[model samples]
Target: MKPKPPTHITVFAKADGAAPTYWECPSCGFLSGDARFLDTEHPCPECGAVGVERRRFPSDRVRRLDERIRSYQKQGDGEIVVILVMTLLETILEDILDRMMDAHGGDLPLRRMIMDSQRSIGVRIGKLFPALAGEEFEEAAAELGYRDFPKHWRTMREARNAFIHDSPFGGPRERLDARMGEDAMVLLDQAYRLFVLLNNRFVADGHTRS
Candidate 1:
């Protein structure tokens, strides 16, 4: 009826290196270099008032973006490891200080401990998402509505610390399911979310692909 949007469309082009040339769109039948629009769906530049799919670049920009996304994916995995380790360590230290501060009843020491932990987390977050560092942690916390995550963080730290210090947490899960199983999962999950967040930021900034 409406031109039945061709069953399929494909593009061919020549490039160096002696390989067959073809650019293709996986969506509705659209040619690679045809009619100026199959990269993303957008308002048609030519037909005026009608919408069309945009064309993708076999251009340097597209290739570069593809490469960058791969690189970020690998880097994201590495950072996830570092974040879990650091957060766990910081949590243990925070727990110890929290107890001390509660016993002492002086805001100075507790404030200092909090500031230190916040700074450490901020520095690590920047390593993962550099753009986030320019903003204050308070603001970020407010944005996330995570004003009281210290307790959770501390628990993670203590769990990790138990594993490190040859404590009961190290026992085989068949013996006790309480500590090791859940804590390890939580840390892993947190690390993964951090990875996703960073990867998304890189894509959004135009430095990488989705």
Candidate 2:
């Protein structure tokens, strides 16, 4: 099953020791991650509304799932690690897309509708992201110093799919090796940083200013 509109995430904090906190406007559902104005004393940048709630971006549920994945990694179960990390990555992508839509003033229903209509990750990254951010996902990632992230993510997804699905033309992949598992771990770490950058740029940019 695919997700939106929903999603492990469990991102760590920067060297400064503050886990990035996403503050959402209860009034309009606008989200922001600007360190300068994380405190809710400022008005909602989108609607000038007060009382923006502080929400940990990964949320508690995601953190719990992350713990399970880490345990699996510790056990050296490469196949399971690959599958779970792939699922987690997709979930994170969907959420970031939703967050970007929210930043652009899309309400819950509207965001849901958009995500529901466009379920393909390739399409979401190739088309939807540009429509919202005025730049290609690869281009954006390049600017953010993860120039190869999208390509690497796509390659990993293909590996995961080959292992999971049976192909009429070619047999399904039988196993995911330790190398793939390690790659997933690397991507997982990179994902947190990439996600934070995207959130800071798209969800918490000028839209949340008082």
**lDDT agreement with native, every candidate:** 0.35, 0.72
Candidate 1 off by > 4 Å: 1-132, 136-154, 166-177, 202-210
When summed lDDT is taken over every stretch of 10 residues in candidate 2, the lowest stretch is 1-10
How much does candidate 2 score in TM-score?
Answer: 0.77
**Candidate 2 overall lDDT versus native:** 0.72
In model 2, state the lDDT of residue 19. 28
- Against the true structure, whose TM-score is highest? 2
TM-score of each: 0.27, 0.77
Deviation in angstroms for 159 in model 2?
A: 0.3
Give lDDT tens digits, candidate 1, residues 69-124.
33433454433333344444344334333332332343676557654666654354
The top-ranked prediction according to lDDT is 2
